[model samples]
Target chain A: MHVSAILTVIGRDRPGLTQALADVVAETGGNWGDSQLARLGGHYVGSVLVELPAGGLPALEQALRCLPDDLTVTLVEVTPEPHPPEGSRFSVSLVGQDRQGILREVTSVLAEMGVNIESLETGLEHEAWTGQKLFRADVQIFVPASLPLEVVADALEHISGEIMVDINLSEALR
Target chain B: MHVSAILTVIGRDRPGLTQALADVVAETGGNWGDSQLARLGGHYVGSVLVELPAGGLPALEQALRCLPDDLTVTLVEVTPEPHPPEGSRFSVSLVGQDRQGILREVTSVLAEMGVNIESLETGLEHEAWTGQKLFRADVQIFVPASLPLEVVADALEHISGEIMVDINLSEALR
Candidate 1:
């Protein structure tokens, strides 16, 4: 049987960190299927997906544990996924003053619309000269196309009006 | 003042989709920012981020109305967003027979852990020879360091065991 594993390496950023991870997986006969490596805030974080023979998991886990303490490892076998009976894709963006209730309010509206938010990212910006606080977010949602688009839009507009922010709902490109 | 718009276009797959989109945005004085376009089934679905002068929205809305009846358009204004608080990022993958509860069960665990999924995609696979079912999902999440890593692993394992599927969580490389 095929056994899938995902390994993450985190430690002070340094050369050879990825090599160390690759070495461990290789030693256990794990096939490195995919990985992502990036530097964030001066720290090195790496994630990899590996496929191994069912018999090789123990060796892989044991090998990973022997690595440095700064590098934490957790593993879960792959699982079955379910497909929605119906779905529609949407894009949502928000612009407003920084406040705590924003995400809750916006996501609540999405939930009521039976929308599944597939991707979301938020960021804060200060006017270079004014230092004024501004919050922004972009979210992509999957909803059923059979639903009236207007209902979703109206819900978002109502929330935007209440929060003194701008909220938009449109079809996603892809 | 700047006005942000989310625009999406979908129709029978054809070559002029991009040009049509660009023409509409250009004529409306809108700057296209982010976009995703792909063919799903026999139709081309596209989503775009655009910024325009506040006064240009009406014209853009009017111009978009000229599209074919099969095309659906949604436009909304939005506010700025702020960055998510700092945290760790992880990758999640699930594979199993296709069904519905998988998303709810898996996301519920993340929600309880204060982990935020950044992006997620799910799909189904059919065995070429046996015609059996296979479902899979890949999700990337941002997890606060304060959340116990073991707890997450356990939750995923439980879901996997119950669903007769596989769930893997690995540290994100970036």
Candidate 2:
């Protein structure tokens, strides 16, 4: 049986860093699958996914521990796992002037509706031109297949209108 | 011109939460594009993205401020920013044994390769039978079009083998 893993590595930025790390993975008989690497605050940050022979972790760990002084490696085993549930999906976003007491009222409604949130990202920015403060949030929700999309949209719209915020719903992207 | 914002509200969790927030957004004539709301640590946490008509914030703020008690709202402005230059898009992932240092090493190599990691997610699970760990990372990157995919894969593979991990590279599903 094959064992799976994901590894994340970080260190001071420099040359030969990748080659050095690759050397370890290559020698371990692991296959490199995916990655993302970037420089943040003058340091390198990377994440990757890999697979190993069922009983290869001991040897793999031994090899990783031998990394050069400047490099460090941590391995994460990837258990072949079940997937997320499937359902109808929708998204809603809201933005307005900065204040208090907004999130509580909105989320309570969704929870009551039994909506499953898939992903949510939020951020704040002050407009350079207008010098105005603004707030924003994007949320993706998984609606049960049996639910009516229009009804959900209408309910959300009612909530948005009541809150003086905007509401829109759509099928999940991707 | 319309102004857009993302709002995040977090406070002790209770009933009638989201509705209070949504009422404010709706009253402000903002369009709620998406949202995410949940409970964390006895506190209700929610985020919403809203698009408002020009000059509608003042009323929106007033409406939000009047929401039923015990909930607070903080608005954040969101920018629909474009991806950065050096214009390359790719995804990468790794699966391997759970350990420290893997993220550090892999990121170091990617930075050396001039890759920009856009988003990353990692998960770890322990095997009940063996007590071994499985690690997985999913990542998206913006690479220089000049960089060859095979070379990238080879470098990642080299590192994976050295670290005794697995890696996969592609345009998506990393």
Candidate 3:
């Protein structure tokens, strides 16, 4: 058994920030897993999944030593699901004029259907020709294998009209 | 000075393979850095960036001991460029029916212009209406701060017609 953690750090961007945290993970004999690290608004922001030997070690807390005092750090321990859910992965992509609550509205629909969002990325880009700021979101969703695909398709089709965006839903077969 | 090593491991897919290698990284007091891991054709394949102490233990190469004998592993040491190239990051996204040499053609154009590719990811996705297999590639390129963006844009425009694909070039301002 191993301990799984999602370690997040947000601070000024620099080259060695991840290395500093990774060194701490190593010193504790932990396995650093997949991560998404990016820069936002002149700040370095990232979340990493790390696996550690179950229990013991104030060492991770000591990771504070490696970072500057002002950074915001959050470490959350993830408990493995008693029974990992059975599902199929699908992709949801959105593009349209930037607006408030687009995410909330779209996700509320998914929530109603009992779908699980696996990963979500939202960004803003200029629309070609129009030069308007366009909001785009790409999401990977987990639909219970027992759920009918056509049902989700129908639901997504219904919501696109309400959300006023070009949304596409498709199976992301691995 | 820290050691940056790109370590690659490929074997039959299993859950604990990365853990085994990561344990070794921890034991050697190395820093585990950014990586991309994926399953391709029933194989567990991954490459990890690990920072090691300058020249000492044969530990990494001996990682062979922890993995099954059939697996293939390779380690490449990246020598920091004497003068790391100065640049602005732009994105190149491609979408079209599957074809050979699309990557070759696109990258060759960038190569001619002395543009450096920072990161690239390629995958097969399906076209919505046609239900045809579509090839997609997203690339982050570093255009030397000295290189005019229009020059690259003009070059990309010239090649898109020849390549028979829809390619979009945009600044991915961070």
Q: What is the TM-score of each candidate against the true structure?
A: 0.49, 0.45, 0.51
Q: Candidate 1, residues B7-106: lDDT per residue as tens digits? A: 5554544334454555677777776554444433334444555668878889989999987665655554444433446667788888876544455566
For candidate 2, give the lDDT of residue B73: 62
| Interface C-alpha RMSD after superposing true interface residues, each candidate, one decimal | 16.2, 10.9, 15.1
Alpha carbon deviation, residue A53, candidate 2 (Å): 32
Give the whole-model CA lDDT for all candidates, comma-separated: 0.63, 0.62, 0.64
lDDT of 1 by residue, A67-90 (tens): 887554554444333344465778
Per-residue accuracy of model 2 over A70-119 as CA lDDT, tens digit each: 45455656543445445676677767564444454566667677665545
CAPRI-style quality class for the chain A–B interface of candidate 2: incorrect
**What TM-score would chain B of candidate 2 score versus the native chain B?**
0.65
Best by TM-score: 3
> For residues B36-82, what per-residue lDDT tens digits would candidate 2 score against the true structure?
45533234454466778887766777677776544556554444444
Model 1 Cα displacement at A97 (Å)?
32
- At residue A39, candidate 1 shows an lDDT of 37
The residue-level lDDT of candidate 3 at B133 comes to 75
Higher lDDT: candidate 2 or 3?
Answer: 3
Question: What are the runs in model 3 whose C-alpha is more than 4 Å off?
Answer: B1-174
Candidate 3, residues A79-146: lDDT per residue as tens digits? 44445567788988888786544555676677677776554556667888999877677766778888
Q: What TM-score results for chain B in every one of the models?
A: 0.87, 0.65, 0.88
